[model samples]
Target: MVNKPVLPLSPIPKKWEKPLRGTVKINFDAAVSKTKTGFGVIARDSEGFVIGGGYGFKNEEMTGDWAKLYAFEESLKIARLLNITKVTFETDCAKHQ
Candidate 1:
């Protein structure tokens, strides 16, 4: 049996925007609540298997937009580094389109 890998979405560095071509899609999403903020990313293969999933949070923020943006941007970078996985993103914050 082969061990599957997991990409923990935390400490998203400043660099994750650079694109890399591969056989995978990335999905990302962010949710903003009155008390806290949440953002996560999931990677799937062509067959739709959950290769890996991760999410980080920023608590006690007055503005959801900042948290959402930071989370989204960081998530993207994290996704790019992990190769051979389809990346997809989802977010409760719709304004971040």
Candidate 2:
């Protein structure tokens, strides 16, 4: 008899967190498909109001890691444009880490 190995499970958050006062929270994500890669970033204030956001697509093929990195970089650019000094960046790509 052969025993099957159990795969590790990732925890899902039940609730979302808001940033501290006078601060902003940025969330970024990326998706890779056979045709193209899509990336986006959104910035929200402490009250959960969206301050700014941007998204783009790459027609060229790319690895998942590269796509995720591009999403993070875009988030930083958006944050800078908003003039937000204090920020908390979050991403849902557990596999990237």
Candidate 2, residues 1-97, lDDT tens digits: the string is: 9864443365665466998999899999999898799999989999999999999998967788888889999999998898889999998745732
Name model 1 segments beyond 4 Å from true: 1-22, 62-64, 84-93
Candidate 1, overall lDDT? 0.61
In model 2, what is the error at residue 25, expressed in angstroms? 0.3
lDDT of 1 by residue, 12-63 (tens): 4442232334444456766678887787877665555566668887776546
Reference-based lDDT, residue 35, model 1: 81
lDDT of 1 at 89: 58
Candidate models: Cα lDDT each: 0.61, 0.87
Give the candidate number with the greatest TM-score.
Answer: 2
Best by lDDT: 2
What range of 10 consecutive residues in model 2 has the weakest lDDT sum?
Answer: 4-13
In model 2, state the lDDT of residue 50: 92
